[model samples]
Target: MNEFRIIEDLHRLQNQFASLWDPFVAAGGSVYPALNIHKGSDQVTITALVSGIDPDSLDITVSGNQLRLSGEVISGAPKSDLGANRVERFHGKFQRSLELPAEVDPEKTTAEFKNGILHLTLPIRESVKPRKIQVQSK
Candidate 1:
């Protein structure tokens, strides 16, 4: 019974160690075009790493508080006879949708791609902006 307990504890310890590397590889196997977003009082800024993809192939859409990103990544296969033995890079059509913290104006939103990074600036809707009310005394 003592040996079984010891084995279980070891297994738990191994799992903890494995989780330490989770941040780097956790969503790596599945999620593509990872995003980083920043929200301010008047706007929201989003950044996504999209290396090795053509700018013309990307499509971005925004509706209310929802933002959609769709694109395709083409693989650069080698022409050598040896061919590829190990392939790890992601390639294909991928779409990711994110909900914004505040409603945004899609008409005013701007997208820029430079150095393999897609940067978006979405202005918060005028209706959603906070306004101050004046107080009256009798």
Candidate 2:
């Protein structure tokens, strides 16, 4: 009985902690457009899974070390006389911003959207790239 009580207390405490960290999960605001970032010595590449979004509606912004991706996910289902009985997919406007590992040159950045994926290749700023210095003999 004592062990069960302890387990119950721990579960309650975990719930409280989760609520404190992310109140949106309980509110049903799930994150969309998952991303993967890869950093190289001279450039950074970012790939985002944006399946249901229109390419024309997508916007990408880059400044220094910051990158912002914004777009809307539109449902293609035709309007039915009856309302949706079950809807599991997300459909709405979404904006997500990420900080790059290194400063990137916005002017040189390239973006491509193909087959529901957005690929970005940002070149690292020349000023921010590491340079090797040689030790001069006195």
Candidate 3:
């Protein structure tokens, strides 16, 4: 009935379409990295599994409520190595973008890479945080 509801419906339809095609396309490899996102009262945390990728190769950007992550993975196999029969590792460029449910403070965001995992902490905007207001009794 409203513009926001219409837009939300369209987004839901888009996700459903993507889900239907995911099984077919995922066999080749995922376009985006595996991710875990958690929202708390004061912050949002995102963790991505990116094994075998150098931290320096990653590019992270946050614009408003959107967060974008991109990077490349390079194989370390020797040039003179014998031919391999099976290869399941992922290489080359990959990127993923996500929209947050709440606004975040980009200036306070922090990222850390350790043990092949990228961890990001985004602080929620002060204006959007919930506050309890006391009612006055006359």
Error of 1 at 41 (Å): 0.8
Give the range where candidate 1 is weakest over 10 consecutive residues by summed lDDT: 22-31
The predicted structure with the larger TM-score, 1 or 3, is 1
- What lDDT would each prediction earn against the true structure? 0.78, 0.76, 0.76
- How high is each candidate's TM-score? 0.75, 0.75, 0.73
Candidate 2 residue-wise lDDT at 103: 96
Q: Tell me the RMSD of model 3 versus the true structure.
A: 11.8
Could you give candidate 1's per-residue lDDT for residues 22-128 as a string of tens digits?
A: 35236542346767889999999999989889999999999999998889988776667563555555566767776788999999999999998999999999999
**Candidate 1 segments exceeding 4 Å error:** 1-30, 80-83
C-alpha positional error of residue 109 in candidate 2 after TM-score superposition, expressed in Å:
0.4
1 against 3, candidate with superior lDDT: 1
Q: What are the runs in model 2 whose C-alpha is more than 4 Å off?
A: 1-30
